[model samples]
Target: YHLAREKKGMSLRPPYRQPHHLASAISLIGGGTYPKPGEISLAHRGVLFLDELGEFSRKTLDMLRQPMESGEVTISRVKQTVTYPSSFTLIAATNPCPCGYYGSRERYCTCTPRQVTDYQLKVSGPILDRLDFVLSLKSSGLQEKAASETSAEIRHRIGCVRSLQHERYGSHSLNATVSYQQLERTAGFSEVQLQRIGIVCFEQKWSNRTQVKLLRLARTIADLQGSETMTDSAIQEAIEWRKLPNVLQGGEHLGPT
Candidate 1:
């Protein structure tokens, strides 16, 4: 009721999506003919925050791929296939490695290269690709820093941007949720911008899906900056965010400090 009232005359609040730890699923298979439910369904309406994301089992995490894309979950029994709504915003956080110190200036990583590879491999490519955003959170090391801005201020900005998108798209979706056709029409990128993206795509060997995702992210960045124009800075940041996983796979590289 509250969500509907807040988003009056529109769709429900997008659900929050989070992943569960692998160890939590160990007791899921009790000696029974009927299968038990999982954590994904419970994270239906609000934030599904996955902490220490890489520790989850690959198979367990892989189960989320379809639902993440389709916004519905299906469980098949001998009698029938049941479906549930799974449209939720995913928010996940993870340390750089198992030792929790890979690429950290404050501490050294004790895990071997093989261990790091295995840990990272637990998170599949398709699953990672489904995530709309990936932000690396770092601690500022000071507890009593002056408050920069309250949530109200941030939400006000988001609301303004949201209103603009609603007026433009005539839908409840945000700029991030704009379709490819809408993006092509509404997001005006210059020839130079396209060329730069083309070069990056070719050089990085980005997939078609990734290319689309990059454009969408760039659009969002532009919106946040209150720029009607999609500048090189916006595109560059989007590309950097998308490329972090690939670079991390190769080896740690300098990022925002």
Candidate 2:
């Protein structure tokens, strides 16, 4: 038995498909014989999570570069092409190595350097650059109870930010979509703040896109503090958050320089 129904709201994708074959790519980004919307379209205006991101093919992952930047995907067919909205927040997770343990205090990574590089390369540089935030989480290494945040508490904070965004921008205009002009008009930064941000951007040798992403992130951090003005602290925090991992920086083995 089967029922046809539309599923709406945020989507969290579970890992699927080995090597992310051409069929898998088509299934996700669309362009099969029928030319239907893919998972990206299905997750429009929501979250599209790839739990085991590295398992997908480098070619398949590269296909996401355009959509993440444009927030839309165009599928070309022999006679017709279809464009689908893919404006979804991407959330990805992957192991540091094929063995699912790299740089872990608890377990040694058994994969060779080549193996590790191959695994990491599955997600291309262009795609990684498109990601707004790329963080590497390590084990907490605590057996006893430690202070932590509940999902509800985190959700409350997010809700507060959403309300603030809606109030400031009028009608839930997210900071992610807001232009530099809009951000400047809404949360204007002072001369001192701009100087500090400029110094950090120059020292870090960050790209123009990274600089823009930092501004957007800083604006969000300011909103989180219920502030109308962007502050140096907010900009610093955003810069810290965008720091690339050692592996991502020079594409070297995980060893001391």
Backbone clashes, each candidate:
4, 0
CA shift at 75, candidate 2, in angstroms?
Answer: 1.0
lDDT of 1 by residue, 57-168 (tens): 7887677688677766766778665665655556666666787776666766899989888887877888767765555645465666867989999999988877877877
Predicted candidate 2 versus true structure: per-residue lDDT over 82-147, tens digit per residue: 888878777777777778776666777788999988988887766766667777665554686765
Could you estimate the TM-score for every candidate? 0.79, 0.82
Clashing pairs in model 1, backbone N/Cα/C closer than 3 A: 15-88, 16-46, 17-48, 18-48
**Cα deviation of 183, candidate 2, in Å:** 1.1
Pairs with backbone N, CA or C atoms under 3 Å apart (clashes), candidate 2: none
Error in Å for residue 252 of model 1: 13
Judge candidate 1 at residue 185 and give its lDDT. Answer: 78
Write down the TM-score for model 1.
0.79
Cα lDDT computed for each candidate against the true fold: 0.67, 0.71
